[model samples]
Target: MEFPDDLKYSREHEWVLVEGKVATVGISAFAESQLGDVVFVELPGTGDSVTKDEAMGVVESVKAVSDVYSPISGTVLEVNDDLPDNTELVNDDPYGDGWMVKIEMSDPSELEDLMDAEEYQAFIAEAES
Candidate 1:
């Protein structure tokens, strides 16, 4: 239920942390909680191109498998190499070590379409209601 103020969120439940032109992406804490305990992760490779609003990876939990979508178009600069072997990180530290990818954004303006922490909280509240 913790939505970090420094991050932007996508409706698909992804969170983004922008630094320079690179964006670090991860599922929000809400997404991880909803997915339950993560058991496996499939991440895009470094140098891979990811499109805005498209799935870039998958996270499988004890409950179900879910696609991890990208919130922006870009070339993947790095992927969290530990995720494949330590999927539990997704549940243990979703906003930190549980991060999925870091992309070099192809269109920075696309960030305008995402929500801030307050907006995302409202979005989640609306969905729940």
Candidate 2:
């Protein structure tokens, strides 16, 4: 329910924040709420190459196991290691500390295909209906 105005989102409920060629990825607040208390996270290592729409990691929560998808094609520059040990961060601050990975984008143009915040909100609304 708390969608940030600046971030782009995927139909799969992933959020992306692009800075220069780097893109930071995470599950949206909507995603975390649906999954319920996250218990563990399995993430790709730094330097891993991820393709758009591909599974890059898995997040296990009290309710379900969800795959974290890559929003754009890129090489992972960094991963948040703290999540596997302290999964609450994903619920408490999904846009900040809960961020899963940062990637050096392979194609910046791919960003244009993702939804803006308003569009993503509308998407969730329609999906929920």
Candidate 3:
């Protein structure tokens, strides 16, 4: 329900914050709520290459095990190392410390395909209907 206006979102529920060529990625607040209490996270290592739409990691919650997808193709520059041990951060602050990865993007143009906050709000509205 809390969608940040500055971030781009995927219909699959990932959020992206682009700063120059680097994109910090995370699941949206709505996504964390749907998944319930997160128990574990499996993330890609630094220096890993990820393709757009590809599975980059896994997040296991009390309700389900979900794949975290890359919103853009890039090389992993950083990952939230604390997430595997402290999963509650994903729920408590999805837009900040809950960020899953930071990647050096392969194509900035790919960002155009993702939805802005307003569009994503409409997207989820239609989805829940």
Model 3: per-residue Cα lDDT over 1-129, one tens digit each: 689889999988999999999999999999999999999999999999999999999999987999999999989999999888899999999999899999999999999999999999999999989
lDDT for model 2? 0.94
Taken over the whole model, the C-alpha lDDT of each candidate is 0.96, 0.94, 0.95
- The TM-score obtained by model 1 is 0.98
Give per-residue lDDT, candidate 3, residue 65. Answer: 95
Candidate 1 local lDDT, residue 49: 98
lDDT of 2 by residue, 20-65 (tens): 9999999999999999999999999999999999999999998799
- Candidate 2, residue 4: lDDT: 93
Off by over 4 Å in 1: none
TM-score of each: 0.98, 0.98, 0.98
Cα RMSD (Å) per model? 0.5, 0.6, 0.6
lDDT of 1: 0.96
lDDT-superior candidate, 1 or 3: 1
Candidate 1 per-residue lDDT over residues 26-128, each given as its tens digit: 9999999999999999999999999999999999998799999999999999999999999999999999999999999999999999999999999999999
